[model samples]
Target: MLIGSLLDEINKKIQELMGKYVILDAYYIRLAVYKAMNLQGTRKDSSITFMVDDVFYVLQKCIRRGISSLNTDCICTVINHANNILLTEYTEALKKNLSASNWTAVSQHLLQGELNNVSGRVQSENAQKKYITHLNDVESSTSCIIILHNESSEILQKMYLSDPPKRLKVLSCLEAFLQTAKFFDSLLSETLLKTCSTIFYKLVDNMLQGLLDLRYVISDEELLMTEVNDPFMHAFCDGLKQVMQPFKKYMTDTNYAKLCRILMPYIARSYEKVVMQMKFNYNGALRLDKDVQYLLSFLTNLTGISVRNKFYRVLQITCLLTFEKAEEAKEFLLIESDTERWPFTNKEAREILTLRTDYSEEIEQLL
Candidate 1:
């Protein structure tokens, strides 16, 4: 019993000492990261930077030493700290640099000639390049994170020579970094969407003004205009497509697809609003359908997403404009009884039905 007690005390002392050592090692590693980050602020010279190299150096050093020493707790401590740093401090740093570029507003201004002076245009141009560089940095960061995770796991297998289960336990101790990589990757995608959206919607606001002019077309002109000669109408969809085209060369397929899906609903809603306001005669209603179909086809090819449902509301409004009688429009809304509901309410239906130039006051009241 005395020997057992002695062994117990020795084991406990050993653990306490290892704990102190491991904690101190992780602290120094974190300090190294902070020092490196401070030394390398907002570098645009490369996709990867000194800060990334420094962080991975310490991380690999920490994990390799822990595995060689068979110190499980040491690896866990280092990985947890690394994960925390990447998600919070590292993410904040990237976001700060990206925001400073003013990539969103600058895109619109650059295209619109809103940057007047030579110096102002040059500065804005530099800022735009910086934003693109920051995005590259994010992509490179995610790649580095993944490569580190894989290499760390390989080091575990080679050094520890453990069975699958034991290796899995150690790998789980490092999984936080994997999750951090995914998070950084997602941040890259989200940032692209935001920048692209800022440019896209700005173009829409400018171009839609010209497009809304169709609402004022005299009835005779509407039937004669051949589906609205307006490039601005095409600019509505094609402009967004144009905005995203440059980024396709930079983004991963998954990132680009997500950007398309998220932004598609906004386009649908905007087109629906514009279509609802225009006064269409019987023939102009035909032109409206033609225009909608062309835009729909263009959007489908551009986004590589199923967009028909997104424009279903616009189609519904087009149908409302085509009806020969308001009573017919009302019947169309009620025909299904309860199986499928139209997106708009009855009052909204009446409002759309009234936009048809041929619908008399009595016909409008019938809706």
Candidate 2:
């Protein structure tokens, strides 16, 4: 019999007996119920399989409560069997019932289920299962809880503070940094971009500082002033700049300068790749005069170079001199146009060439 139906039958019997007996003892009543249930299902020494289709089915329904007492010896065994039988049905029901409010619970439960490894974890098994479950429950449906992060950070901190190896700590710090960033993105206000920037900078600072024990981590002080190469650093710097772009409308000159100072590291880091790409190849050889002049001036000032004198020959032919001289100078400087081959594609390559030539001419004029 169904557990619900059995429960209903037991409740009815209890009601009827309550009205019949003047001094009905609770213990005797309970024992009578257990005995009646046991008679319906054969009580084997190994396992208790309650037969629901037995005769006197109405009275045998009392076995529902006795199952608990009977489970004392083989509760795990019963749970295993019960779980095995109900697992499929439970998951199907859960899938149909999932919603945004309960996504977090579903994600957690699914993760735990994966860890249990009932469905084996192959190369992509864990990732694929997690991907499917996450996509279905959170990503695609937008109706499930987002597991932005787990307990990875807490575990990392404890490991680091104790006696973690240097290599292990570095990796842990990197993972923690990424996880914390993701967590903040999911939780923080969208308008609080600067707030996120500050947090991001702090994380970078922490990561760099953590590597201080390594010789290579402490780079040359001059190298710090040099342009950056890491794309992540560039992105971080750009993000800060974008966040503070609107501040000038409200900020005082002094406040703006202060903000710029705060953003300098980010800007420099982010601008490094662009600067290097510009130095490589610039195709706007004869046009973009103003842009070229600006780039030259900017580079000269930043690099402490008097481009007017340092690169006078190279710039002169590229701008004021003959086309032949310009061609010769380009060859001298190994200035091959990066976009010459990928004319129809490579948007970034085109932009770089345009910037590079302008900057090159500006530097020549300044020199």
Which residue pairs come into collision in candidate 2? Answer: 99-143, 100-143, 103-145, 234-270, 292-358, 307-367, 308-366, 308-367, 309-367
Instruction: Write candidate 1's Cα lDDT for 59-95 as tens digits.
Output: 6676666666566766667677777877777788778
Error of 1 at 4 (Å): 5.7
lDDT, candidate 2, 212-288, per-residue tens: 23221122452343233333334433443433333443333333443344434443343333332322222223222
Error of 2 at 32 (Å): 75
Off by over 4 Å in 1: 1-17, 20-24, 31-61, 64-68, 115-129, 136-198, 215-230, 235-238, 324-328, 360-365
TM-score of each: 0.73, 0.18
Number of backbone collisions per candidate, in order?
0, 9
- Give candidate 2 regions above 4 Å deviation: 1-245, 264-269, 278-282, 285-367
Positional deviation of residue 8's Cα in model 1 after best superposition, in angstroms: 5.7
Error of 1 at 262 (Å): 3.2
Residue 11 CA error for candidate 2 (Å)? 90
Angstrom error at residue 280, model 2: 6.6
Q: Give the top-scoring candidate (lDDT).
A: 1
